[model samples]
Target chain A: MKTQKIIDLLDEFLGGERIKRTRREQAVLDLLDKLERKERKLLEKLAEPHDADEIRQLNLKLQVNRAHQEKARQALESWAKTGEAEKSDDGVAI
Target chain B: MPACWKSGHCLATAAAILAGAALVSAAAFDAAFARIAAGAAIFLFGMRFMEDGFAALTGGTLEHLLKRFTTGTLRSLLFGIVTTTLTQSSGLVSVVTISFLSAGLIDLAAGVGIVFGANIGTTTGAWLIAAFGLKVDIAAWAMPMLALGVILVMHPARGARGLGNILAGFGFLFLGISFMKDGFEAFHQAVDLSAVTAHGLSADLLFALLGVVATVVMQSSHATLLLLLAALASGQIGFEGALAVAVGANIGSTATAVIGSLGANIDGKRLAFAHLLFNTVTGGAVLAMLGPAERVVEALSAFIGIVDPTLKLALFHTLFNGLGVALLAPASSRIAALLIRLLPTPQAPGLTPRFLTPAAEAFPEALNQALRLELIRLYDNAVEIMAHGLHLHRRILFGAEPLESVVERNRDVVAIDLDSQYVERVESLSAAIVGAISRADAKPAEQAEILRTFQDACLDIVTAVKETKHLRPNLTLYVHHANADIRIPYNAMRLAVGNGLRAIDQLRKEPAEHRDTLELEALRVRFEQDDREMSGKIEAMIRDGRITPRMGMSLMNDLRYTRSIVRALAGIGRALFGEADATHGAAERVLGLSDDDISRLARGPS
Candidate 1:
């Protein structure tokens, strides 16, 4: 599943239709995939019954991932609005 | 022979005979005068023509040789010697040396070496005249040589014709000498000229002053020396007077360099001072040891078994200069340092207000080096501005409270009016670099690459700063996106910026040696790799639906902009390295990157 997701992202990145996306977007996509996997694992563990310690650990993990995702999402939004997320083939960003 | 020789008639006849002798001698005098004048003209013209032809043939090659081969003082000295010998003019060599110094081709020490060698090379002409003229009776062969020279002048080959003119000039010189000798002989006997026996300086001071005055008028020590030789040969001037004139000639020759450096830069003026100080000190030393030095010359002459005073004088010229160079070579650095101190620093910045001085502009290498330095400075300022913009970007992106100290400092530092002009200047400088790069055909591919990169970097920095300024209301979203981007692609961009700063700084510090081609290539590759990785991350984030469409688009554009800045930085590095080949690859890559990848990277994880 992760491989397929990565392949899809790579395909999308390489596609010529989008005027804005570039190689830098692929890096962000990879990071997002890792975050998603961590989040999915955390949710699966949360569905099971657990002792107080395990429940607390799960919550901590969930909170950390949520923070990471939120940070990533905000950064993405900034990139989107600024149209600066795509690494120009020229390799310069203001 | 006519019967006009008894009593008053005899006396009248004797007077007429004397007058006839004077008339015949006067005609000889005219002939000699004509030959000397013609010879001098041919000599001067030949010197110039030969120098120009040699300069044309070897000017570029010599400059390349100097630039490539001069590694130290010794090599520089040798280079000066070789060039002066080939050109046959110390004055020309000094001018070239000064130009090299002004262009910053050689450091102060090496320049001194070249100056030293040039002084020695100039004496060659004097030796040639003294040695060859004193040998065979050139007068007997002068007519034939002159005729041959004239015939050769009509040759089709310009160079051969020039050589012919030079030979003809030499013949005329000898012919002139022979006539002058006869004219003096006739004048002495026919008229008891009291003016020729006027009392003059037997004192050292007066003799030295005479030497100085003569040299100043002639503007050449060789001419002064030759005149002294002629006077001595005629028995009109004593040896002491001739020697005094020689000393004064040394002092007078320094005027050339001093006048040459009138409005020149600090280095040029310093070099002129070096010339003056060297001559003065050597003259003083020679004066102090005049008795001993003369004895040594006599002894050396005896040892060499040569007997002519003219030859002795020529040897003295060589010996004095040789001694001066030997004594002063070790102390050259100290002398140069003292000159620098005496001149003091100029109150104003910049060497000259004009961009390129006319003297400096003549040499292409010098002009190119100056242009390169200007570009490096411009690139450095651009990097600083970009760094400032990035700092502002970070502040606006994160809702983290602005540091109070920074805010207070900014309040004082950021005079809106002043900064606005500075900002505009920076923008204009970027545009100027672009324009210059576009116009340059010398290194076309390299220049184009540099221009494209510089433009991209300028745009990125401007956009980043402008967006950061506007991110006040959207601080929350901007901060979140920035944090995520910072971990991945932004991290690489930041590193690229750091590397770019280092490269630019290297150029600033040591432009001559720091234009490393390999390192720049490696940096370029790293930038490309980072951009590729960033693209992948951005795509996955969008595919996972972690970020909204609006957020994704924003992320894409911002990261693309960042990469563009990196590309531009890379371009600057390539230009600094003088590599034009990589520009096409950079351009192709820029065209190939897509916007979707940028959007995905900006969106982050689901």
Candidate 2:
């Protein structure tokens, strides 16, 4: 009976501890999960290049992705250099 | 004498009296004209000589001071009064005021105050004539004053020579008035000239019209009024006729400002309109209340214990102007607004653009204010040019930019038809400003720095055009890389240009007590630091294998050119504020940084 009471208490504690995320937060989590899945697929495709045409197509896609990443890196770099990242949401910097 | 012929005899007697009065009136009118002509000649000559002399003596310093200090309305009014008083010609003051307005040196309100003050200052001439010439027997001192004047003219000192010329002019003015007065007296004694029996209002209007025509012809109200005074003194014309002529003279004097503002900017036109408004309004008001005005003059003369009729006329002139000023003082702004509304038009083009005229340079107080506006323009232009460079560079770097075919064709079409004309206009304006500064008595350092800054700006524009010229064919890897590095130099140029512009504006606008040379020095330091950083970055990219040596060299050249451009801009601020030494020290420091050190610094972190 005491063990059963402890299990009930633990269940209540676990339920209380479970995160109650807002809709926006849940959407962000879902997007991350999708991105992780896409990243895995892209890695698989990159490993299994068949013909020259396919390789070329994959290379182009990779180039586009890399360019996007570089842009993000550059934005962060500039922000770090200028200390202007704090005001990014406001679209003004000093 | 016969009883039956009594009616016929009364008619003949009345006709004879009328005929005599007509003859007298004609003679009086002729005498008045002659006296006026003589006085006008003397007045114009005296005024011309005195204006030139004052200008020479002051060496533009007084004008510079006036421009520098008269930023506000009250100060401007006082400046106008003081300057006109010193120069002894309200017309001269008005011309200078118009020039200032044309040059974009002063605003509308300040310009109005100066005009008001000029009117007050002009009264000094009449007072001098009335008080010293009419009141005191100046004959005794005239010869001595003339002799001293000649002696001073021959003196070694230029300033003394100018003063001597002014004194000599004054002597000549008094001498001429005396001669004219004598001529009138002789004419009066020789002929019975009186128009009192004629229809009063008709005669008054005729004389008033004559006064207007005479003053317009001579271009001097003083001369016209002096003639009226001579006519009154000679008993050729009654007080009513003389008063009407005086009123007309006021209207006619405004023609000078109108003529002076012919090709001036909007500000000049506004000023001319203000003068017209003041004179017309005052003259009309006084004429409407002529009866009351005459009584007031008589009462003022009685109160002042002035028994002479000519003295009464002079007192009347003084009282009228004083009362007009008193009434108009509070209404000046409203009057100015109305005048501006009446003559609303853009300033005439190809005439100093109202932004670069020497009007502000004429007064020392307004000079800095004018300079501040100019610096703002310079800053804004630099910012715009830097922004364009950034946009172009970014497009070239990220995008697969098309070759120059269609784009070049379009640019060519725009350039040939529209852009060329606009560019030419700006170029001409810049050239004119340079020419004006060169001709002016500006400090050498200031002149050199401004010219250099303008040249650098022009060169930057040329460089941008040159780079964009062969758009498609020159899309080499090297070219793309060069475009990417353009940002470093462009940003450095922006920092330097902004700092320089701000420094100049602050130097000009800040109060004397708040101005600090160290502040300017610090700005120069920051500009140099940015320039050094840009140079180091280009070198570091090469050292780190991110860029080829050729690419680094090209980037270095651009960075060097940009640094030089920034240095020139800073030089302008330094020149204006008399801080050339600080710029020189900065140049030396930049030179001291070795190539090896610069390369190592450019490498950033290990």
For candidate 1, give the lDDT: 0.51
Candidate 1, which segments miss by more than 4 Å at Cα? Answer: A1-94, B1-60, B134-202, B349-606
**lDDT score, residue B464, model 2?**
31
lDDT per residue, candidate 1, B437-497, as tens digits?
A: 4444443333344445545544544443344333211221233132444223333444455
- Model 2 stretches with alpha carbons more than 4 Å out: A1-94, B1-64, B67-75, B78-88, B132-199, B345-525, B528-606
Assess every candidate by TM-score.
Answer: 0.41, 0.41
TM-score of chain B of 2: 0.45
Per-prediction DockQ scores?
Answer: 0.02, 0.01
RMSD of every candidate to native, in Å, equals 26.0, 27.0
Residue lDDT tens for model 2, B185-296: 5443322224432436666666666666666655566766666666777787887777777777767777767755554545677887787777777777777777788888
